[model samples]
Target: MLLRLLLLICAPLCEPTVVFLRASPSQPIEGNSMTLTCKIQHAPLKSDAQFCFFKDGQTLGQGWNSFPEFQIATMWKENSGSYWCGAKTASSKAIWSQSIQIDVQRVPVSNVSLEIQPPGGHVMEGEKLILVCLVAGGTGDITFFWYKGALGLNLETKTRRSLTAKFEIPTVTESDAEQYYCAADNGYGPSLSGLVRITVRIPVSRPVLTLRAPRAQAVVGDVVELHCEAQRGSPPILYKFYHEDVTLGSSSASSGGGVSFNLSLTAEHSGNYSCEANNGLGAQRSEVVPLNITVPTEDRKELLTSGVIEGLLGILCPTTIALLFCCWLKRKIGRRSARDPPRSAPSPVPQQPTYLNSPDPVQQQPIYQNVNVVSGDEVYSLVYQMQQELQSAVVEPPRTRNEDKDPSAIYSWLKKANDTDLDYEDAM
Candidate 1:
């Protein structure tokens, strides 16, 4: 009866207790170390206890004095299986712990970058950029998928056990260039690598160069800037300058592909100048421009100086000759005017005739005389002869009177007859 009572108390005290398993970083990177922890429900009264861990029905480690811990070394593909742990006392049979399934996961990703053909060192539109996904320590079927913004891109697989996967997007456009991610999976949940930022860098179009000058006649040995410009093109272009069929210098344009050159020129550079612009696609040349310079003439200055001294003498000689000729002509004309008279004048008067003549001989007769008068033959004959004698004379006859008794009467009568005859003749 005492032995039966003692056996019943020992049986109740010898029962086994369980410990729970704990892991750090519940998720771990491949090929790196990880720790698993175990804890006992009750501390053993005696320090003599046995602990053992098993995986897939095989022992992992065994110890006579056991603690609540287990560690796996150099974890590889073979270590990926189910695991469990149990504890036992030295005086009792071992008890089992709950089963725990551990799975060896794939490594996290590294080193993802975009590769391009005719690489611009960046991905851009109208250029084909290859996407490569690589893992350091993994071997399985890989699917190359591309993610853009929020969508996934599926690519056909070429190999099953390849650690690297490649995706080819031919003739990439603007939409293809985006933030991209690639994932590798062998029946494991998707582990996305980092991102590849794609920037579509469009190449510059054909550039055009134009040149200008502030003035048409750009003098030699003078400061001048020749402007070079592009009409339609992308920026960041390089420009080269030329002068007089010879190259001078080079420059770059960042924004508008416009550049200028400041040249302190010499006489040898006074000719055509041109410029060329390029941006990898092609090059353009500006039109040829010409420059000229002017200088003072030495001969012209000497000629002007000599002309000043002789100018007054040359002017006065001709003026003096002309004045002398004009004075002589005026004096000759005055003398001719004084010597000539006008034709309009009156004529002289003629002499008158006068009459006073005594050229012919003449005779005078008596004024009166007395005479007798008878009518008988003797008296008649005497009277007839006296009358005949009186008729013969050319002069006027004398007057006569009675002879004897009346002499005084005869004078008176004769004077009266004379007076009557004078009166009768003057009347006729």
Candidate 2:
């Protein structure tokens, strides 16, 4: 039993036992201190023993101790290689512990920067602008976000060394031009950039005005139209039309700028006219225009018979005088002819039956012969009847001899028997 106890004591003196070794802060930052230790497995030997640390087979340092420990000061980033601990005795060589690796990390970035680029001197109403954000140095996933007027507007994430985000404000109005800011996140936390105020400004261009009339000329008591227009201006601009230094009417531009007003025109309405346009910035006045109106006289009317009355008078007076003179001369000549007597031949009875034994005055006178037409039953019957009469006269011997000797006496006797018929025939 004395011999076994002696063996145990002698064995510890010859070689030392190391149970566990440890390193604080498994993960560490660059340029910071750290510690490494080697612990004995059993109660340390009363006789002094040595402990050491090594890296890739190179010895770091040696010391005598109960348990050996390493104090690394100014542990630079280069000290991040593999390392281990060992325990040694005077009687034997050193024994190494299990190897351990160290890590060095970078700090998260803070206080980012922001830059803005607007389209003009100032952001115009209804105009667009852009904002950019930047950071110093950080790794792994990161997020970017933008804000306007305390409201989150955009957010994004990236794995690259640098990140970018874009913002668009369409149809920027007065309300849109406000304070804006941006921030970055690395999952550890978020850091904010600074904020800036935006202002909007615009100038009103030239305005155009127009006029309209009910007719080419505004006559008395006629209704006329007046109008105003602008060649270039923002919509919803209020327009006021004026005439002769008086306001005619006011209207707002809906699309293309134009407005009209109606007025009952009179002779007094003839004058100059103008208009003004405003969009809350300023008002612009148009050039002056002049107008004049006149009234017309009524048309003349004519009578129905005015043309023919003079012509009728000129024709009738000469015709009446000529007809009266002709009738008066004709009556005078007839009266004169009746008053004058004609030279007549003397009667044969008035001359005495002288110079011979004139048997009788009536017998001495010229005998008148007469012829009479007789009617008959057929065309030659008249001839036949006259022949019969002649034969009868011949057969009566006394009448035949008497007619042959005194044919004039017979003719005279026939004329005297039909005197009215003989006188009528003589007048024809």
Candidate 3:
């Protein structure tokens, strides 16, 4: 009993066995790696010893294994605490190593990257754009900077403890479509990220259509030009023209601008016209414009005047000729009667007189029946021969002075010629 007591009393002073945990890096920086080793001071069989690690009284692994060391691939501020290890051997009970307090220090920011939300990195106009500045390794408080183009255009500056920082744009515009960059600083110099291109696409706006002609008024056979333009849009715009809902033609502009299409006017082309502008996103149409083809009133008036003049000449020419021929026939008849005076037969009482063509048994033939077939000279010759015969046959009859001077004897003949017994004559 005294020998066992003496051995126990000498064990602590002579061969003191001290179990402790050793850290390769005494002060580990956040986002760095470290290793912990558990060992015994007087241990001679370390390979047979199994060890397990703990931080702030919480086990790091499932349990004890053959390994006597613990490793941490990454370190953070949350892992800064008092750490210890437990060692167990096949022939002894579990033993706890001395605990050590570790402090994780803050590190400078590095490996900065700028990422755009809604992946593929294209954001249209008026949409929200998010720029996230992230650091692969950093610690403690850090300040993030967002910029566009150069440093003169600093978009935002924020200080936080997170490894990532965000800058949001509620509404993106054309000015925001330039190159972007992000930077991070944690007491050291700023770590700037590479340039990232952020393009803000703009959709096509409503188009405006205009019709141009050589004159103020459009007419048939005029070549009219149709101009379609959108106030704002991206490049490579296509323009299409429509007349009365029918497609006329189309044109394209590689750069953002207007386009024109030529149209020939006709009578059938009078109607509403419109144009459409498309940039692949969608098509926008312009307000309808009306086209009217006109025929001048002066031309129609001239044609009407000429037609009226021709129609009047057709009717009046024939009537004018007929009037002139009647006047000539009347004058010729008066001349014939003036040359031959009427003779009257002496009555049996000798005081009464007879006025007739001839006071003879021979009858005078009507001249009107042969007026169209015979000439005026032939008619006069026949009348003169008959008058000579009549005079020779009835020489006892002669005209009185008052009958030769009668003014009513030369008008025209209206009485029947067969009633020649009455010594009456018809005036020429």
User: Best candidate per lDDT, number?
Assistant: 3
Which one is best on TM-score? 3
How many angstroms is residue 376 displaced in model 2 relative to the true structure, after the best TM-score fit?
Answer: 99
In order, candidate lDDTs are: 0.55, 0.59, 0.76
Q: Deviation in angstroms for 289 in model 2? A: 2.5
Candidate 1 to truth, TM? 0.33
Q: What are the models' TM-scores?
A: 0.33, 0.35, 0.49
In angstroms, the error of model 2 at 176 is 13
Which rank order by lDDT, best down to worst?
3, 2, 1
- Write one digit per residue (lDDT tens) for candidate 3, span 4-32: 99999878668755678999798998878
lDDT of 1 by residue, 46-103 (tens): 4666667777888766643456567764454456777766667767677667776666
Q: Decide which is better by lDDT, 1 or 3.
A: 3
Candidate 3: which stretches are off by over 4 Å? 1-24, 32-110, 137-142, 160-163, 296-428
Give the Cα error of residue 369 in candidate 2, in Å.
Answer: 99
Q: What lDDT would candidate 2 get against the real structure?
A: 0.59
